[model samples]
Target chain A: MKIALLASTTLDMLPSLADALARAHGLSLEWYVASFGQYEREVLDPASGARQFAPDVVLLSIDADTAARDAKSFRALASQALVSFPTATIFVHNLVLTAPDVLSLLEWNEPESNARMVAQLNLELSGVALGSDRLRVLDLDRVVRSLGIQAVCSPRFSYLGKIPFNKLGLQAIAGQLVTAINAYRGARRKVLVLDLDGTLWGGVLGEDGIEGLRLSNDGEGKAFYDFQQLLLKLWRSGILLTICSKNDEWLGLEAIRTLRFMVLHDEHFAAHRINWEPKATNIAELAEELQLGLDSFVFLDDSAEERALVRAALPEVLTPDLPKDPSEYPTFLMGLNCFETLKLSTEDRGRGALYVQERRRRYEAMGAVSLEEHLESLQTRVRIRAAHPSEFGRVAQLTQRTNQFNTTGIRRTVDELRSLADVDGWQVLVCEASDRFGDYGLVGSALVAQSADGPIVEGFLLSCRVLGRGVEEAFVAATESLVHPGRGVLLRFVSTNRNAVALKKLVELGFVLDEKTGLFGRVAPMELPKWIELETVSL
Target chain B: MPHDNIFPRIQACIVDSLKIEPGRVTQETRQEDLEEWDSIGHLTIVLSVEAEFDASFQMEDIPGMTSVAILTQHVEASGSV
Candidate 1:
């Protein structure tokens, strides 16, 4: 992706940022340094060859207040850039609140600078991001706070001392900028696998009973409760939630059921293995249940022992350390930008409900004596929908969270997915499953990227709750039928840490395994079983 | 532990702060003789000497703190016992 950066002031920190950007694998950046402090007609020329380079992404680091005051010129500059490079993803940074010394210059005695400045900055940022479908706004406030520095303050600038800006913090921000750029160019992780005990709650369920669990009421358990609520929100935002616990199953269930203080119900977790088994095994089971690969799973655990076990056992799992204190849980979890930094979509809001409905279906299937009886009793409904603006968010969320049944196990951001929806050869399908109990929201998602080989299943995933009821087979059959007619089309099942369960279906579909590579491939005539009804919508 | 030998110890501070080869730090060696002796590096020398000799150098003393001889004098005047 070709990127251009526009700065309003001298980027004293650009050297470090340039270094970081250089290290980024697939990005080519062309920096257009425009210092608002030294605005000149020659420097701001819109018709210059620099603007004609046609960047895929543009960063506007100019201060909002300054831009607003010189709106005509700034807008002209922005307009020229937009017109010259029509499809560029424009990013506008919010103005940082000045320090006390800087604020003291203003006439108002108010502790904070004029609300007008802050409001204008937010307004301009929103305007740009909303005005252009390709534009995005990076929250400078969040970035400043994450750096543990007051963004507005000069911090006693001394040329000899370390640079005024926090080096580590700026590096993180730069890294996120790079991630956002990559996501705009189509690269994002799909699933978030979380550890249960110290990560999700304030205390361990086995050690601290449900009554003793530190979850919020009004104040006492506020931090833990707030963190759970945040996770719930993330799940709804389309990040898949899986549990890998090394605890007694009954105890874990009792805590979720009996703990009045608990905020996350059984439904919040899409797939969980709460046995005393090593976390790696549980994580594997989770991946299998969710139909995701180990490569896509980001594991969070407070215990170093469990984290080490998973890190050693499954090297592909991205394990971010869980901060020791419960208070830092929310901040720590949110800092992991693997799934959070991407644009939010509608599919995300309905994700929690989908997972909940999936769990309800699983509960209903419990203790069914025969496979036929369970299949018949499921009363499952698979709703396939064409890619629509309304379903884009949930579709993006499903793309991110669905793992176990996933074919290639790739994830994409909503923006990227939307762009793909327009591409001629690609087919993006979302599968929402529900039973007699309720709506499963969006239980499955499939993406077929057309290639010379055939319509390759780039992603195939089903919510774990809907796993056992022939949903995987039914969904695959429907997907194949949609793409392949009369003739047999090849299906690829790439083995992953979690999708072992899908291995059976791969073989059952008559896919042959390469003795050396273990990559299963086969050609099978696609047929949806008569009992299952498949509904689909085309874009 | 002779109190008068603090001058040699101050020289040692210069050598460590400047990250120069021990023998390269001479009494007349200017700041340019050492590569790491930038503005921040100079402040580090003052801080290290102050800690080693239990003395404090004034802001004015910081600029004249170019070589080992000048730095040693500043340290001694500040009452390094």
Candidate 2:
């Protein structure tokens, strides 16, 4: 990934140091550092090297004095960068206040004080981040605040090379930025499988019963309470929770249901396997049930032996070594660098309820007489239209993330998607779906192009949440109505390891394989499933 | 291996920061004697020495203290370190 590092000061060593820092954490990023104090020029001039680099991520590390004196310019620069590079996520820095700013205690509280100005600047910077999904604040003030500004700054070096901080301080800044970058790149762990005994609470359920277990707002149980609080936050942030415990089913379920301080109840978990079985087996079963790959799992167990068993059995699953003291659990979990996500969309925040709905939907499937009737019972409504400019962010995210249901398997950045839509004869169809259960927001995308032969489905994909509800067929129908592929609609698809799910029902969808061109084409128009109600959202 | 002797540690800091040969730095060795010891390298050496000895150098003491002996003398005089 290309990363452009533009700073207000002479940070000649930052690019190398930041790249080394990222490499240390298993991320490979190519750095393009602009010349000293050329941040504005680089952003304003379209032909500048940084602009020509066409980076995926940009880190603008502005100096404190510049930030305090004039934040509006920086905000303007950020906006300019947004227009300059549509694909990139711009992370602008918050000014790191040194001792000089707060040295005069009498003037510290003054309205025009440097401290007040920078604080206001940071708030404005945060607003800049909130302005768009692609923009974020690098938040260097957090590091400087934690480690006092006196320790981080070097006046000698500042005078010499226009660089402010020492090597240690620079590394800390780099670490924070890289974490934000990783989160933006969607490298967050997807699931957290936890042990119920001595992990979620202080005591084993079978041994001590629900009354004896420690979990409360205060006292010795506070540790467990705090741990649960963090776990619940992660669940809300879109990490699926599950229990992989070696305990009887009823005992665990009963304790979770009736416990006053149970932050995560049975409804909170997407899946649970509470039988007295090997935890690795239980976790694998939960992964299968959730339809998530094994690699996205992070298993937590209080017992070192259980952690070792899961670690050895399933090397793909991340099993962090447990600290014996339960008091250290919350802080230890806080120290782990696994749970970081950049964008929290409506779909993401409600993902826990969505997956829980999946379990209920499966139960509904079992209750229904047939698959067709089950589909009818779903009552899914799909809104499809030309992809709006505002939705390109989610569309790009879907293209990168949606693998199982994606045909062609080609990932496009927002810049490429915009260019595609701008071309003379192309259409970018976006679909949002809802059912009797809930809304599967912005679940599908299809990129179509007019070729010499006919309309081509350049790339098509649907979110797996809407998979069984006939949303894909409805999305295709909406696309066909727009394209009017007379000879037939042809799709450009090449098989990948994870994309076989996209190709399975192509023939049933009226597409025949042209083995010679390796394309799927249908001479007849696609029929939208009767169960799915399609509406064209005139954009 | 030795305790209460900050001289060798100060020499090591200079060598490490400047990337000089081990024997190139002596008690009397000055910045002019080493090819790698430029003005920027001098500040880098001070920064490393600051980290090594857990001491912050006075800005006035940096420019004149070019020799290894002067650097070591400052470290020894900063009794808390």
What TM-score, to 2 decimals, does candidate 2 have? 0.86
TM-score of each: 0.67, 0.86
Local accuracy of candidate 2 as per-residue lDDT tens digits, A377-454: 988899998887878767877877777888877777665777788855578888988889877688888888888867
Give the least accurate 10-residue stretch of model 2 chain A, judged by summed lDDT.
A480-489
Question: All models, DockQ values?
Answer: 0.09, 0.29
- Chain A TM-score compared with the true chain A, each model in order: 0.72, 0.91
Most accurate candidate by lDDT: 2
lDDT of 1 by residue, A1-539 (tens): 45565666434444336445646544566555443343333235666444665656677665544565665666555545555555566766666544333555562556445545566556765776676655677777677765555532223322334233433444555766776766554445556777667766667788777776776666747877888888777777767777777788888778778777677777777777888788888888777665556777888888888888889999988887777787888777766666644466544566656665655555766877777787777677887755555565556656555556666666665556666767655687777777676676666777767767567666666665566666666676667667764443455566666567667776776777767643455566545555566676544
Candidate 2, lDDT over the whole model:
0.80
For candidate 1, give the DockQ.
Answer: 0.09
Candidate 2, residue B31: the lDDT equals: 85
